[model samples]
Target: MRPQRLSDVVGQQHLVGPGKIIARMVAAKLLSSMILYGPPGTGKTSIASAIAGSTKYAFRKLNAATDSKKDLQIVAEEAKMSGTVILLLDEIHRLDKTKQDFLLPHLESGRIILIGATTENPYININPAIRSRTQIFEVKPLTLTDIETALERALTDPERGLGKLPIKLDDDAKRFMADATNGDLRSALNGLELAAQSTPPAEDGTIHITQAIAEECFQRKAIAGDKNGDAHYDVISAFQKSIRGSDTDAALHYLAQLVAAGDLPIICRRLMVIAYEDVGLANPPAASRTVQAVQAAQQLGLPEGRIPLANAVIELCLSPKSNSAMVAMDAALTDVNAGHNGAVPDHLKDAHYAGAKKLGHGNDYKYPHNFPNDWVKQDYLPAGLKGSEYYQPKMNGRFETQLAEQYHRLRKANQ
Candidate 1:
């Protein structure tokens, strides 16, 4: 059943749980303009539906993938007169800058409670002006537990679920189905329904779905080149691993396969990531060279672009590799995610603003440029994170060699 209430909604606890911002908004009936950003089938639309269902407000839906300015204008006019209108804008990034700009006025005026959904990051896809005007909440992908619960409800709920059908799901089939769905509830349910429909009746007169039956029902292999399809991730993984494993031959093979399949840009990007992540400072040239490959591909366009791509791949395969840089960045990002954010140091605080100096913004700040050899000790990081080294450059090429000499000199001079 399409859940009619928030309690019935699966996943998305951070937004709808007790005392959450959205929950408070719903209770007070103060639903404002918001953008829900996440991957497909993460219940962005369902959240909008729940909000609309709870109120005596007008509900209008528009898919930016299909709707034009005229459609938006019609909705805007209706919203202006209505007490409250929950306008669902799906794939709003499909709208050009001009069209996105057009919605800004209505959103700011509070005429429409904008509930925009995008699979892409809105900051990258949406106009900054419009993005600033709306509250953005990211919807996380559904977990396996969430999918299992939804499937259980679907199997038993007589009114809108599969209770009417002669279907029986074994534990293995249910587990496989959940894994295959990969957090997309719509796909999971669709797969289950398809399997149930195709499954033959068992001796007990119920349609029992097995692993083989499920696979047979969904056997049309999704093309490996389709970016929005299942093959996209698999191909990219194969390509990156081949390079990382120093298999230039296999790497070239996958590269050619991607090129022949016409997904050249994706291949270029995968190489770029490998350059930075796999090769890194062990050979800084890898990243520069990977960038050049992308530029060459853009310039020569196709057949000739293959030359630079090949050269870059071979070079990266032969180069000394290190993940030190990548590891440092990832570790720092993990800390940020864990909410270990420390405050800015006083010396590092901006002193350009009026009265900033009076507030001790730059008190005791040391100018490294004025010090001997431009080397001085000062609190570069926040007080709480003092002596916390994020980037411990490995002893490798240019970065390591230079850093080693500097550290030696600094130690001797300070002593």
Candidate 2:
């Protein structure tokens, strides 16, 4: 049975609760085209149906993957005849440009209230034109309490639920189903219905659902992760941040999530980037070790691959964090982009070219190798950027501390 009203929606109270966006829109009788995005079985379609039922508007359902242009034509015709209609389009990310072009005018004219639903991120998967015209809302996964409440309603409601069936669900069974579905109400309800229908009633004329029966119905809850969706980027971002923050446990947790999702290649690549971007200078050896670990993970592959990945993650997390290198590069790039095209000094220009001495190339250039410590005070930057100090090393670790000391000493000697 579908939700008949907004209050009947299981979760996402942020959008459907009193004084929420959907409730405010319904109260004002002003609806706009919107896209509902989230993992599957998260009440996107249910919310759309509930809105249509409550508003008493003509409602039509179509699948973007299977429906043709003729289906949209029919909906457009009906909306014109009825003055308004709400169309619930599923898998909206799959809608081609042709269908988007067809729906644009209707959406703009306020004749068809479009409720587009997808399990993909709209910003990444949808056409800009379509995304710009619609407000996007994220429907979150249902909590265990919400799933349990829905199951109870289905078992007792007379009109559209299994009220006539004498199904007696034990407390353990109810909790098992709620927890086994992993926040998916649809899976919980379907499993409950299956157990109720197939189980033989006892001598007391009661169909008892036990923990074993519930497990049989729903084997394992699938982890919600889409490699091409927002979840992938979100996990990767969390992983990097954890490492940068020096939180070893948090970094390992996100690493395990990616490992469980079987995205080893992405994990390896992200680890390498984090080594240089977040762990640079402070621990240069960490960068080298990270590169080697990634190579090892790639060669070993899977179960065995996770070991090397874990080794790299722990090393990076515990290593001193530094963004000085990243900042230095960005500062230099900013000057280049700002048209700071100062000519190179003759002494610093390419001197190996033929007849270079005639142009004064390499003239008066101090050879660092010829001096004490194999170093000399020299101008390497362009003429306009003289005296610019970009590499400011942070003294967070022993290596960087030594480097910073040497840098200050050299600057004092040059002065």
Candidate 3:
């Protein structure tokens, strides 16, 4: 069901409620081109419809990817006749240069108040011309209470909702519908409608919708909508944090959540980052395997991909954790960033070029491979910043333990 006024919008009170941006625009009658971005079924269209209805303007809709320029001409004609028309352009990110050029003048002259809707980051995907003309707004996912309010309204509203049907929705069933959609109001409503229509009326002439029926109508469990949306990021953050915390079970739980969402690219990317950032030098072999597992996962798509991904996740969680490499790098980077650097020692400078020996470059340099144990103690740091120590190896794993021993030994010899 679509809202006829901005006040009727179920969620996004931040934008549509009293004193909000869109509401202020409608109240002041200062309509301008705008873009609404979020996951599907979050009232982008409803908000556009409500704005048009509230302002007494004609409402039109067309998909930028599928509709032709002829379709836009029809809306422009209507806008000319009616003075103003609110056009809801779906997949506005896909609007080509041709369509954009045709609509630019109408937007400039205030003939058409374009309400562009997309699931993509409009700033990155939309052409600069379109973005310049439109004020971008993000429609957030409906909260549990917000979805419940919409559900209740849909049950009793006779004009645009399934009011005539005598249906009994259990409390648990209602919650199932809300949570299963992950803040998608449209899917929840559709699933509810499916349950009500498919189930035959009971002996008392009332159709009962239970949680089990709701699940059946959903068919698959919640596949998170909008990979860039907040909920998806929350799950991903939890996934990486669990692995870093060495909680294998919790890590797998989050992994399963992401796998169900089917964002393989993000899964592979985050896993590789965790391998080096969280489980570095302490378990180099495990980190290396993590990289290989991600490669294998990429080769084999989902279902099979999940196998290698799972192995990588388990190994990373159980491996001895160390961030010493990351810490060391950060320490060095900090010095460089803060202007704690100086000119390289002449001995360390290249002497291959002509006249380099006259500049004293490499004149005192001693090759480390020619010395005992392929090592030599020398002043590697510049004179102004002498004896700088960056690496502090952790004795968390066998490899790093041996590395720490050699590193300290070299330090002692230099001293």
Top lDDT hit:
3
Find the number of clashing residue pairs for candidate 3. Answer: 0
The parts of candidate 1 lying over 4 Å away from their true place are 68-82, 96-109, 127-129, 220-279, 285-323, 326-345, 370-393, 396-402, 407-415
Candidate 3 displacement at residue 305 in angstroms: 5.0
> CA shift at 150, candidate 3, in angstroms?
1.8
Per-residue lDDT tens digits for candidate 2, residues 210-243, read 8678767876322242322245467789999999
* Candidate scoring better on TM-score of 1 and 2: 1
lDDT of 3 by residue, 123-190 (tens): 89999998988899999888878998999888998888889899888776787677668788999999
lDDT, model 2, position 254: 90
What TM-score quantifies how close candidate 1 is to the native fold?
Answer: 0.69
Instruction: Estimate the lDDT of model 2.
Output: 0.87
Per-residue alpha-carbon lDDT of candidate 1 for residues 156-180, written as tens digits (9 for 90 to 100) = 8889898887778876566556655
List ranges where model 2 is wrong by over 4 Å. 221-415
Give the lDDT of residue 190 in candidate 3.
94
Q: Give per-residue lDDT, candidate 1, residue 210.
A: 71
Give the least accurate 10-residue stretch of model 3, judged by summed lDDT.
Answer: 220-229
